[model samples]
Target: MKIAFVGKGGSGKTTLSSLFIRHLAAHEAPVVAVDADINQHLGAALGLDEAEAAALPAMGAQLPLIKEYLRGSNPRITSADTMIKTTPPGEGSQLLRIREDNPVYEACARTVRLDGGDIRLMATGPFTENDLGVACYHSKVGAVELCLNHLVDGPDEYVVVDMTAGSDSFASGMFTRFDMTFLVAEPTRKGVSVYRQYKEYARDFGVTLKVVGNKVLGQDDVDFLREEVGDDLLVTVGQSPWVRAMEKGRPARFDELEAENHLSLQTLRNAAEESYGNRDWERYTRQMVHFHLKNAESWGNAKTGADLAAQVDPAFVLGERSAVPQPS
Candidate 1:
């Protein structure tokens, strides 16, 4: 299962992301946590040792190798072998060597961290390259997806991608890749507005989403969000001073935490487990294609009309289902 987190900046994506790795690791589920945000923080939140962080290069480093292998560089360097080799260095290397067909494999190499449990956690640094364009995002994300596709062989493995805030290319792109996307927002008008915009964009891409309201403080804040979004509140991460301290790299007592504490993280993770099922990307793409292909004309009319609804409703003169048909 591939799970992704998206929210406005400072909306606690990294905190929840770290918690996800910890939760999965505790339960012995192999996880690859990718930090897709430009400014990375998942490492620090997870209490990663400097040495461990330094060893794992961004998955982007393998793009050139991927191109080479695709052009028939070597039969032994399959997608699976390449991902296994490129993972955050640790004992997974031993398993590589045991699979004799892998020519590049070496025994006992530090490639991935296996905490003597069923789970192994690997994290990718954030994407900060600024020459923004669809091609650049696609290239980087393509590599990340390639790596994930290689590591996660079946439904047993899970990937947690911590995405940057706002309705930007990276955030939108993250939605396209994951089976399900979680949109996070704070208890402010700005946060709600941002998620709403993100929701609109996600709809354009036909993304299946669930919203999370983080940093919920009082009844008023909760009521406002409930009114704006609706009663299907996925999870509300309570506002906690300790959470802020954690962001600043300080440790605090759990008792000091408030309602906007990690409780939402627990709720979010639970929803993820419940919502997760066997996913087929091909099926998702087909459904999306149908949506756009079916609504192509109405969307175009909406663009030209004064009111967007005028392009869809039968009551509107310019609508696709209107009484009179207009010229092209």
Candidate 2:
């Protein structure tokens, strides 16, 4: 399953994302953690020391190769610049598998060894001085989305992304790329407001969103979220003293987190595990086409639209209702 964690800047979504990745690793599951946020803190949150995290390359920095691989040998793709987020995989496009043998994996992924299991980390680099006025953070995020769109993960595997905070995710269709999105919200008006905005926009895309309340101090805080989000509220995580200690430079593993924090992590794991099922391939492909056509009309060429349309898997668009299987 592919899961994304998004919310307000201080909502603790990054911390939660790291914790979930650690949880999957502890269970010996195959997982790749993508730090799609501009701040790029998921590495440190995953227990990588400053130096180790700094040494890792960002996927955004490898955009040239990424685009080249994705374009493959497709004759219709004349230049990498024409490759948009909704660009479908074509004849020569490289298929990404979580295993290290995949060229895409070799090009961008870094394995971080942890006590439980080693997890691969892929980052989207922060916007640099050169990008000033020349590019937007959305461009960096778009690289991550493009990589994900080309990836095929096993049922027991996961791709956990830490998305940019707040409504910025709506800047691109990246918000619709996940099987599930965990919106980590603080028990405050502003936090709940972001949730409302996300739900309203994502409703039409068939994206499943669940709320994870963070930094809840008391029943009052919990009640506020319950009232605002209702049953969409899945887990409420109180401020973790263990996390605070770690922030202070104390060493701590995920399993050693405070009891409350550990339980909250388990709740998230259960939800993810239970979420495993069949994907609606027809619906997914239709949505991709919708976004691709919309993008083509706005910024892409007519041929780009035609090429993308032709790339949609026949079984998916032909109304066969067959399962569009991925690598297991």
Q: Which candidate tops TM-score?
A: 2
lDDT of 1 at 185: 78
Q: How does each model score on TM-score?
A: 0.63, 0.90
Per-residue accuracy of model 1 over 1-328 as CA lDDT, tens digit each:
6788888888777787766566566557766567666666766666556666556456555555543332232222333323321122111111111112221111111234323233333333444545454334444554554343323233556677887667763321335556657877788888888778767776765555777777777788888888888854676667556656866767454434454444555676667666556455444434323332333344422443322222121211111122121121
Cα lDDT over the full model 1: 0.52
Cα error, candidate 2, residue 285 (Å): 2.2
* lDDT scores in order: 0.52, 0.78
Query: Given candidate 1, what's the lDDT at residue 110?
Result: 25
